[model samples]
Target chain A: MSVLQIFRKTIMAVVCKPIAHFWFGLNLLHKERLPENGPAIIIANHNSHLDTFLLLTLFKTNLLHRLKPVAAADYFLKGGFSSWVSLRLIGILPVTRERKRGESDPLQACYRALERGDILIIFPEGSRGAPEEMSNFKTGIARIARQFPEVPVIPIYLQNAGRALPKGKRVPVPFVFTAIIGEALTYPGDRAEFMEQIRSAMAALKEEAPQLKWPEQES
Target chain B: MSFPFSLPSNTSLTAIVLIYGLLGLASLIYLFQKQRGGGSDELAARLGSWWVIITLMIVPLMLGALPFLLIMSFISFVALKEFLSITPGRMEDRPIVVAAYLTIPLQAFFIWLHAYGIFLILVPVYAFLVLAYLMTTYGKVERFLPSIGIFHWALMTTVYNLGYVSYIMFLPGGCNGTAGNAAIVLFLLIATQLNDVAQYVWGKSFGKRKILPSVSPNKTWEGFIGGWATTALFIAIVGPMMTPMQFPESLLFAALMPLVGFIGDVTMSAIKRDLGVKDTSSLIPGHGGALDRLDSLTFTAPLFFHLLVFTSYGPFAMSCS
Candidate 1:
């Protein structure tokens, strides 16, 4: 094995192994929700740090398959071995959310990854929002759906990622959690209409678990 | 083989006795407190068990036995028992054989003897293969493979990792000075425990951002940063006092130690979730069972041991020299 692979595995063995050990509490509400094959976008609610690994472990796929997680450039890819492992070894695709005017858009990296038949995980609630309700989602996901209208967009509601690793906390309180993968929402043709459908679908997904109270319905 | 602190001295012995006595009393009181409310028996149980862990760590060291091996075997046995108790095993299964429990003590004994070669291989390779062969000899039942595999891996990870504590204790030049030995062991323990406490404190106090919402709900960015900051500070401060290493180096080691320990804690949390249980067992009041207690130690032991082993000496001569 290459040195990079060895280092990645070693770090994963030490760090991610525990995450897998602790948070396998996920109950897939709809296994059939995921497409059997082809490129897709997994749009989920951002909650805790555990979101990355837990989703990776719970998402349906052959054990042999690999999925790329699109994480924030500023946080997940923070300096040192932590970043290297997350991006390179764990296959997280980093995207910069905020940039100066006329700068490159972050979604390009994700758009390319999705085109390659790789699944991309996106948190539409720009960042982790309040526990009671999801913040207004950024239109990035809708735009991506429109861009790759052919690819399926899987709506996933992570029941407790927010509570597990709330917005500002470091330590996760051990609790039972489930990653509910709702039915896939394909890119509806109209830009405005499609955004509304996706938002309602995500909100409906959040309702399945009464534990999370979705924010007031946005018009 | 004699420990320096083991020598006779009434003052030192009395002080040791008083300390342990107070701790034991506190544990009992904590146990009683649990019974009183009629609501906190679980916490009481955990706290009571924490006494034993603390005792094993502190009392023996105070008495000068340096009973590190004893503690290792005990933790291994306890954690293994916790694993087996939760997991069902058939009486007829050879891997579930009586010989397995017996091996717990023997493997511990090998570790005590510092037999690295035999100790490491005994579980994963030899014992595992033997158990599998025995299972095969009985003919393959449909559910047999997975059942045997889980049992074997659980035992191997729990018991073998426990044995590794011995390897850690004997790391060459890792414990050169009297103070150095105490510092290293204490530093490891403190880092592990402090990581848990600090994370909880941080998460509880200032958590707002959600990092992973599904697996562990209470983890937060605020808590992570605050806990990490405090832990790093503690590491820097306590690192120098406990070891021969200078401030920044000790600080760096301390910081890494807790991060590693945090990983260990979460790993066990994940395992418990898979098993569909909480707190491993009710063996400890106010704390979880042995598995919960040993969770951090399992990862911490290997990490701390390896760090010392590699830094102090080459891989080839880690245990023996």
Candidate 2:
């Protein structure tokens, strides 16, 4: 591992993991379904800042060195200290949220990372939404999956994160959240169908672990 | 300060050795049973984990007070994590969560510093108010009361109550001298754990009536009374040598241990039932989670600590060099 990766691991083990475990009571279900080797993409519903931390804690320590989360550059890499934290501490691949005409592809960094056999975590919803509800998925995940058909797209449903550390909240509320990893999917040469497949897979996961669902969803 | 290895002349080395010897014998019996095709894998795993747990518990005692306190804090952190992982609450209570996590180290630090005033009220008073204030700032009113209530209870039980175990080392020496404090902690641990095992063994062998069929089906009147009587007898016999307590006080302490421990175990069970989880998490091999192992300790520690204090056997009762 590089020195930065080592440092990141240390901080994660000592500080982040314990705090997350203590506060959110995080549980990762079906983690064995995660691909062990080669390039893979993890697509999950996003509702809290805790989405990435919850995802990171699920992987074995050794795999962490090869994992990079796809974060919005405009938010995470705003400048200075945060940029350094986004790049070094958590190893985020910043995808620009907005691009001018003739600008480079925002997902180019993600594609290069996948080419190098790194696991990329993508929030297909594109931004945080209300707790227990999902937004319409952006087609970015489909584009990447089609480009690299060999890379398995693993669908995950992050339950209760929005309630744990909802948008506009720096600290997380002490709530137990779950990361439900669904079966992996490959590109079927139809982008819309693929995105719908991923979305429905997550929706199915929400039903499977209904205990993690919000009270409103139950009603 | 001298290393704990120095073994103060008054330290109860005999009690320590006898306990481990009993554990060794139990392991041997289990092994022999396994050879006869009678032992289950779950029992074997439980015993295996017990060996690691026993060593972890004893090493810190041998290292001295600071290490013991730090280890207790770590245990509290794990227990709290398990409890929180099973509880259902809001996402907006992040501030309260941070405050609760921060309280673990702060509570341990208080014990280390022997700041009795702040240590006693930190969670029940200050933390309670701080969490309330934090919840208000979040501006999300849904399930607000229940969320704050859970947070407060988690901190109180996990951090505040468990933290009392470390304070035993700081207790004033009574008839056995300063080293007797370690013996007091060892006594509580032995009695609490023995009560748990004895209750299980007796319940399995002779139990017929359920004590609380709704909360815990496994618990029975036979087991409750049997475990209580046996553990109390053990404490009464061993108590004079290991603790500052005399025969009668030891008997009282013994009786209280299992009763409170029963409460703690069932309380966690009720929470688990409410949360719709069988076990808190599959963290430990045979044991369910850190919370499962610590359920008895949570209630016993605070009660035992207060009993010592009320009986004039705590740190406040005597002076140290």
Candidate 3:
């Protein structure tokens, strides 16, 4: 394994997995559904900075080397320590959220990574939001899925991550979080239809465990 | 510094050997059953994991007090992390969470220093008050009662109660005769864990009538009584060898230890039931979380600690001077 891959594995093993298991009480369901081989797209509803770590924790150790997260360049690759962490430690593929005057296509980075047989994690919602509340997905994932029709797009719904670390919080509170991985989807050939399918699939997962519903939805 | 290869006395050695012999025989029977295609893969996996756990536990213990204390602290840290992870806490409670994590090391440090006075009050008295004040600084009363309660209870059960195991090493040698402090700690672990196994086995074999159907449906009266009797007998036979307690006190210790350990297990089950999760986390393959593995220890450690201390120093031992 490469040094960066080794570093990522060590961080996940020593730091992320333990913290996720111990501090956040992370439970992963239907992880067996995750394909054991080949490239795939993992799309999830982002709730906290923890969403990335929580999702990564679900995969077995050896599979981690094949996993590359697509992160927002504006936030993660602004240069300096954050850029180092994004490029070196996590090995994230930084996709520029905002297109600059003469900059290359952001999707090109993601497309090439997927073509190279890397399993990519993408939060189609674009950024973090409140728990149980989902934003409309950006079409970047749909566009990428269209380009790589052979790669499966797996949808994951993360519950309670917002309460664990939420946006704007440096430290996370311990809250039991669950990651529900839905069946992988082949791109339906229509971007809007694909996005809807992904969204509905995530919504359908919320019904899997009634107890995991948001407190407001209980009564 | 010279390390002792053997336990302080022949009694302790005999007790260890007997325990290992029983485990070896159980593994042999399990292997035989597997050959006949009558054994479960789950049981086989559990036995395999138990070998690793036993080695991890016994080796450090053999190294003496500091290693044992460090291991116990690491367990507490993991257990507390599992406890907090499963329970819901708000983002506003971040400071309190940090404080909770910070308390683990300090608590272990106090036990390491043998500052019994400070160690005793560190979590119950000081960490409680400090964390409560820290929560107030957040100025959020949305989950005031529950938030504070979760933080306090997590510390008490995970950090403070489990810390008592390490403190077992600090118990005055006079309390345990020449069997040594390691013997007492090992005795508690053996009785508590064996009680769990006996209860499960007896429950499967002849259990009828639920003890607490709502909380833990699998727990049955037959298992409870059978386990209690067996564990109590086992302790009575082996206890004197490990602890300074004579027959009557050994009998009392054995009886109470299992009962308390049962309560601890059931209490954790109730919490899991309320939270709608099976185990705390799946850190251990067949065992569930660190909390699952250490549940019985949480209750037995503190109760046994006080019982041994009081028995040794009499009623005035509360001062622990």
In terms of TM-score, the best-performing candidate is: 3
Docking quality of model 3: it rates as acceptable
Per-residue lDDT of model 3, residues A1-219, tens digit only: 778778778888899888777666755667678878659999988888888888788888778877888998788977899789878777788877888788887689888888788899999888887665788888888889999888999998887778767788776666667777899899988988988898789888865532531245354
On DockQ, the leading prediction is 3
Indicate the worst ten consecutive residues by lDDT in candidate 3 chain B: B312-321
Q: How does each model score on TM-score?
A: 0.50, 0.77, 0.86
TM-score of chain A of each: 0.81, 0.92, 0.91
- State iRMS for model 1: 15.7
lDDT of 3 by residue, B141-225 (tens): 8868888988898999999998888888766655666677788888888999999999998999999889999999999999998
> Which residues of candidate 3, in runs, are more than 4 Å off?
A1-31, A53-65, A80-85, A98-106, A131-136, A146-150, A159-165, A171-182, A188-197, A200-219, B4-12, B314-321
DockQ of 1: 0.01
lDDT per residue (tens digit) for residues A1-219 in model 2: 678888888877888788766645655667679888658999988988888988888777678878889988888877899799889888899888887899988889988999899999999888897776788999988889999998899998887677766787665555556667899999999988897798789888876453632245443
State the displacement of the C-alpha of residue A83, model 1, in Å, after optimal TM-score superposition: 71
**Candidate lDDT (C-alpha), each:** 0.65, 0.79, 0.81
The interface root-mean-square deviation of each model, in the order shown, is 15.7, 4.0, 4.0
DockQ for each of the predicted structures, in order?
0.01, 0.20, 0.33
lDDT of 2 by residue, B231-303 (tens): 8898888877777667777777877878998888889888776666666655556886778888888899999
Clashing pairs in 2: A163-B91, A164-B91, A172-B94, A173-B93, A173-B94, B172-B315
Provide chain B TM-scores across all predictions.
Answer: 0.77, 0.94, 0.93
| Clashing residue pairs, backbone N/CA/C < 3 A, model 3 | A22-B81, A24-B85
